[model samples]
Target: MKNHRKGHLINKGNAPYVLLAPTILIFVLFMIYPIIRSLYLSFFELKSGCYQFVGLHNYIVLFHDRTFYKSLFNTVVYLVIQVPVMILLALAIAVLIEEKFLRGKAFFRTSVFLPSITALVAYALVFKVLLNGDHGLINYVIELFGAKGVNWFYGEWSARIAIIMAITWRWTGYNMIILLAGIQSIPDSLQEAARIDGATARQRFVYITVPMVKQIILFCTITSTIGTLQLFDEPFILTSGGPNNATITMGEYLYDNGFRYLKFGYASAIGYVMTIIIFLLSALQFKATAKGDTD
Candidate 1:
C-alpha cells in the first residue's frame, strides 16, 4: 500500500510536466538551440562549409567596417525620425478616436485600424507601385491638382520620406490600438477631478492622461526603437535601400553579408552586435522610465 501510494503521488506530480513536455521540447529545440548555436557561430569563421575558430576577429573587423557604420547611421536616422513621429501620431489618433464627439466611432476605428491587419509584403508592393517615379498614382493625383508630379523613387530624401510614410501608415493603427487601451484603463474620475480643479482640457491631458499612460508609451517607444533598428521590409521592397544606400538599414546589411557575400561569420557578428544594441537600448529605456517615475 505504501509503495502504491508513493507511485500514485509521483504520477500526479509528473502529470503537468507530461502535458507541457511537447511545448517545452519544441521551445528548446527551436528557440533556445538556435540562439545558443548562433552565439557559438559568432566566434568562428566558415570556410569551405567548415568552421574555423576566429575568436574576436569577426567582431574586431565589424568595428572597423564602413558599411556596418553606414548601416548603423541609417538605422539611427530611422529610429530618431520615424519612431517619434509614429509614436506621437499614434497617440494623437488614439486620443482623437476615444473622444465622445467623434461621429461614427466604429467606422473611424475600423478604417484606421485596417492598415495594421494588412500584410507587410502587400503593403510594400502597393507602396512601391504607388510611389513609382513615372506613371504612379500619387504623382498622377498631384498632376490632378495642377502640380508637377514629383517622382518619389528618384530623390534620396523622397525615398526616405516615402519609406517613412509607408511604415507610418502600416504601423500607426497598431500602436494606436495599444495606446487606446492604455487610455481606456485610466479612470474618468481623475480627469473629472482635474477639471473641477479649474484645469484646462490640455492640462488634464498633459498632467493626467500622459502620466497615466506613460508606461504604455515607453513600451511602444522601446518596441518602435527595436523595430526601426531592425527595419528591412519597407526599405527592402520600396527602395532596395537605395536612391543610393540612403535606406540601407542594419537588417539589410546583415542579409547582404550573410546571403550575398556568404560571409556567415561576419553576418553572425553583425547579428550579435545588433542584439547587444537592442538589449542596451531596452535597458536604457527601462532605466529612464524608472527614473521618470521616481521623479
Candidate 2:
C-alpha cells in the first residue's frame, strides 16, 4: 500500500508536465529555435549565401558605427522624457475621472481613449498634414496667432518632437485606463476615514491613496519602460529616421541593417545589444521600485 501510494503521488506530480507537453514543444520550436539561430548568426559574416565564422566582428563594427550610437542616444532620450510625462499625465487624468464628482465620466474616458485606438498610419498621415511647415493646419493656426510657423520635420530636434508628440497622444489614454483600474480598486472607507480625520484632499492623496496604489504605479513604470525601449513604429512611419538620422531608434536601425542593407549578422548583433539594454534597464527599474517599497 505504501509503494502504491508513492507511485500515485509521483503520477500526480507528473500530470501537469504531461498536460503542458504540447505548449513546451511549440515554445521550443518557435521561440527557442529562433533565439539560438539568431545568436549563431550574430557570430558569423554572411555574404552571397556564404558565411564565415567571424566571431565578435559584427559586435565590434556596431560599437564603431556612428549611426548605431545616434539611434541608441535618441532611444534613451525618448525613454527618459516621454515615459515619466505620459505616466504622470495618465495618473492625474485617472484620478480625476474616477472621482465621484466628475460628470459624464464614460464620455470623457471614451474620448480620451479614442486616440490610442486610432490606426497608426492614419494618425501619422494626419499629423504630417497638420504639422506641415507652411500650409499645415497647425502652422496656419500659429500664423493666425501672430507666431512664426516652424518646420517640424526639417530640423533634427523638431522631427524628434513630432515623434514624441505622436507617441504621447496615442499611449497616454491606455496608461490612464490602467491607472483608473488601480484607483477604483482602493477601498472607499479609507478615503472616508481620512476625511473624517480632517485630512485635506491633497494630504489624503499624498499620504494614503498614493501609498496604496504604489504597486500599480510600479507596474505601469516597468511596462512603459519596456514599450519605450522597443519603440519603432511611430518614428519609422512618421520621421523615417530623418533629418540626417536624428530620430533613428534601435528598431529602425535594426530594420535598416537587416532588410535595407542586407547585413543580417550585423543586425542580429544589434538585436542582441538591444535585448541586453532592455533587460538591464528593466531590472534596474524593478530593483528601484522594490527598494522603495522596502524602505
Candidate 3:
C-alpha cells in the first residue's frame, strides 16, 4: 500500500503545483500582498490607531505640500546632472581599461571596482568627514593653496554637489564594469577593419564602438535613472537632507513621512506617486531607446 501511494504521488497531475506551492505562496505574501496593501492604504488616513477612508485626501495634501515639491525638484536635479556625468565617466574608464597596451590592467580594473562594493553607510560617512566645513581634508587642501575653506554642508548648491560627488564615486565603477563587459564582447575584427579603413581612433569609437554597445548603454541609463529616482542613503546620512532641504530626495521625504511622522497612509500615497513616476519614466526611456534603434 505504501509503495503504491508513493508511486501515485509522484505521478499525480498536480505534482508540479505541489512542488511550486511554497514559492508561489512566498511571492504572494511578500510581493503581491504588499503592493495591494499599499494601494489600499494610499486611499486611507491613519487616525487614532485606525485607518479611515479619505479618498484622495493624502494625494491632494501631498500636491499642496511645498516640501514634497522641493524634494521632487531636488531629485530631478540629481537625476539630470549626475546620470550623464557618471555614464560618460564609466564609458571612458571602460574604454581605457580595454586598451591592450595599457599596463596594470588588472590593478586598474580592481581599483576602479572596489568603491562599488564598499558599504553604503560607510562611504557616506567618509564623504561627510572629507567635506566637513570646519576642518575637512578638502578644505585643508584648499587652504594650502591660499584659499579659504568653503563650508560644503552650509551652502545649498555645495551640499547638493557633495551628495552628487558621493553618489558618482560609489556607482561609477559599477557601471564601468558593466560597460567593460559589453566592450569586451565586441569582435576584434571590427576594430581592425575600422583601422584598415583609415578611421581615426575617435571616429572608430563614435561610429563603431558606441553603436555596438548601444543596448548596453541603454540598459545602464535606465538603471541609473531608476537608482537616481530612488536615492536616499547618501542624502540621508551625509547631508541629512539639510542646507535648507536642497539635497532632499523623494526617497528621503518618503522615509520622513512614513517612519519619522508615523503617517503611514500619507507615506503610502507618496510611494504610489513615486511608483507612477518611475513607471512613466521607464516607459519613456523604452520608447526613446526603441526610437533610437530605428533611427
Best by TM-score: 3
Per-residue lDDT for 94-155 in model 3, tens only?
Answer: 99999889999999999999999999999999999999988899999999999999899988
TM-score-better candidate, 1 vs 3: 3
- How many backbone clashes can be found in candidate 2? 0
Better of 1 and 2 by TM-score: 1
In model 1, the worst 10-residue window by lDDT is 150-159
- Model 2 residue 209 lDDT? 71
Query: How many angstroms is residue 181 displaced in model 2 relative to the true structure, after the best TM-score fit?
Result: 0.7
Error of 1 at 31 (Å): 1.1
**lDDT scores for all predictions?**
0.89, 0.90, 0.94
Q: Of the candidates shown, which would achieve the greatest lDDT relative to the real structure?
A: 3
Cα lDDT of candidate 1 equals: 0.89
TM-score of each: 0.93, 0.90, 0.95
Name the lDDT of candidate 3: 0.94
Worst 10 residues of 2 by lDDT: 208-217
lDDT of 1 at 216: 96
lDDT of candidate 2 over 1-295, digit per residue (tens): 9999999999999999999999999999999998998899999987778988999999999999999999999999899999999988988898889878999999989988899899988998888888889899888998999999989999998888888888888889988898888888899999999999999988987998788888888888888888887888888888899999999999999999999988889999999999999899989988998898899
List the candidate numbers ranked by lDDT, top first.
Answer: 3, 2, 1
Candidate 2 runs further than 4 Å off: 1-26
Give the higher-lDDT candidate: 1 or 3. 3
